[model samples]
Target: MKIELIYPRWKKLEGQTTFHLPPHGPVVMAAALPPGVELDFLDENVDPRDALAACEGCDLVCISMMLTSQVKRGWALADQLRARGLRVLFGGIASMLHAEETLAHADALFLGEVEGRLGAVLEDLAHGRLQKVYNFMQAHPPIELVGPARRSILRDELYHHKGVRMVDLFHASRGCRFKCYPCAVAYLGGRSFRPRPMARVAEELAAIPNGRLFVVDNSLAQDKEWEKELFRTMIPFKKTWCSHTIEDDDEVLALAAQAGAWYVYQAVFDTSDFIRQRVKRYHDHGIAVEGTVLLGLDDQTEDSIRRLIDFLLEIDLDLAEFTVLTPFPHTKCRDDLRKQKRILSDDWDRYTAGEVVFQPKHMSPARLQELYHLAWETFYRDEPQSMKMMKLLQRAVARERALGTYRGRRRDLVRQSFGRELTDEERGV
Candidate 1:
């Protein structure tokens, strides 16, 4: 059976530049399909028309999309594919959260992780007995079952403009242990960390085309022992990699750097004076810590936003990603925001973490939007002569050079300033 898997793109907005790549979920799923089922994967975020065309010869189509923005486009594509007489299967965090709604359009909805249920779904399809829903909760299908995903699947031409020759993505673990108010990880993978064996993970990392690695684990240092094992195994490669980590362990940070982790994405939830000291420590370790701050938490105020921004500037971190507090489906923040009536918009497309979905307790939505832009402008606006920026520029240049293509792409709604603060359109209450 020919199966086509798709990842959709959101509508474009002015001044926003989106980094489009095939998300890890569908690619991992494709890796898991039982033998004899021909597979084609499409990341519509790169080229929508080509992705849609790739679906032409497939008997079955599977789609995975983000919950907030991509659902509308995902549903539209599924409906179109269904109309053309192809069996449509849907899954992803979005589908898992809104399974019944997604089922209205899809012939089957594969909820949760796709590894365990994928084979059964395929088997059922072969016998013309496909089920309406397949859930693979807490099941870790063997890594070897899905043939190693070739790095060639991502176009070499995409990274050319930045001068980076190659990039490869690896998944070392799944789920998050912390119950961050705005996170969707706990909802999808539960509040526990399930790491693949260190040897298995290292082997997969070794298999990728380029030596450059991006470990897609939510938090890499949740388990110190596993992390130590991983670092030990990776030390031999001496290849530079990037991953997210919490701010607790100095040993783990040092080991990660020794293991070729050039970039560390660290979250500074509440920027206390103590946390500021930790941030400085991370920078002192020769690791380019991209310090991130959440702006719309319950107690966020303008003074707090400015203080956080000032702290980030003071720390002289390499890069930063500033995001509003989003209440995604199945997250504690979502429930809390619902209860507090803080959600400003229910449009899933606006929930990209870039937009203000919930009203702040201490500030208006407009002020929040202003602060969001201010954070980006403050960090990226000033061109610095520091080695960190130089290194980031080098990496960015290398990445662009490796991809070999450049186009003037505009930013999306989330990246733009709101002319007027928008309110929930669905509410007449």
Candidate 2:
């Protein structure tokens, strides 16, 4: 059987540098498909026309929706495909979060992790006994069954920017132990932290052909020992990476630095000394810090929001991403806002973190929206995100050079220029 795996595109955050990092969910799902099935993976972000053409000879069309913003488009794609007599399957984080609504648009909806389970779903498809839903949300397979992602399905050339390859996405674990208010991960992947065995993680890492990666675990801080071991396991690979928060302990941060941690996205909710120290700790370990600051929280007054923006500048974060709080389905934030009848919109498209979909306790929704843009403008005004990103790239390149994995042509050009004496014009004389 043949399947066309489609990762529907969504609107990126406004004012952010637009780049597509090869997605992890689709490639991982590709690995879980039973052998002998021809797979064509299409990321619609690159080209929607090519994804549309894949429907020609495919036996099934599978849509993977990772973000809430992507669900509307995913539903539309499924509706279009199913109209032409092709079967459609929905899976990934967004699918689980919006299962009831998604089910209406799909022939079969596969919920939860696909490892050691998707084969049966395929068997059902082969026998004309496909069920309406394959719900595996609570039945996470043993972590050992997780294998290397089928990254070969991706068109490597299409995932680059300015001739530099984008980082390939990888994961060493699933689920988050903490149930943060605005996050749906706990409901989607459970509150228990589920880590893949070290051996399996090592296997996948070794098999990945990219020299850089985005370690997409929900949060590496869940288990200290596992987090440290994961870094140790990764040290020999000499792969530079960035990820969400890591354990704040000194030893864990040191191990991560040794393991080629390029930077990390850490939450900077307040201007407290503890938060300041946490950013400093990561920096002291030679890891750059990217602040993921969310505005419009119940505790944040307009004055406090302005204070938080100034605090970000004071902390000297390498970069900062500003997003308004969004109430995604199944998250605690959604429940509370729904109860208060303050949710202004149920349109999934506006659920993109960049937009204000609910009333803020301390300010009007319009005021909250204004502050959101203000946060971005204020934080990026001095250094600008692109320049900051270039600095991070320089760090990654230096790290790669130290590890003997540097392969960029620009590095060779820089070395040659330094070897020769510069003329007057070149020296800006």
Candidate 1 versus truth, CA RMSD in Å, comes to 8.2
What value does the lDDT take at residue 223 in candidate 2?
A: 93
* Cα shift from native, residue 175, model 2 (Å): 1.6
RMSD of each: 8.2, 5.2
Error of 2 at 76 (Å): 0.7
Q: Which tens-of-lDDT digit does each residue in 190-209 have in candidate 2?
A: 98998999999999999987
Candidate that would win on TM-score = 2
> Who wins the lDDT comparison?
2
Question: What C-alpha lDDT do the candidate models reach, one value each?
Answer: 0.70, 0.90
Q: Candidate 1's residue-wise lDDT over 238-309, tens digit each? A: 566777873357887777767767677888766687767776776666666787778888777789888888
lDDT of 2 at 128: 97
Model 1 spans > 4 angstroms off:
11-17, 139-147, 150-152, 159-166, 384-390, 393-429
Q: What TM-score, to 2 decimals, does candidate 2 have?
A: 0.94
Residue 188 deviation, candidate 2, in Å? 1.1
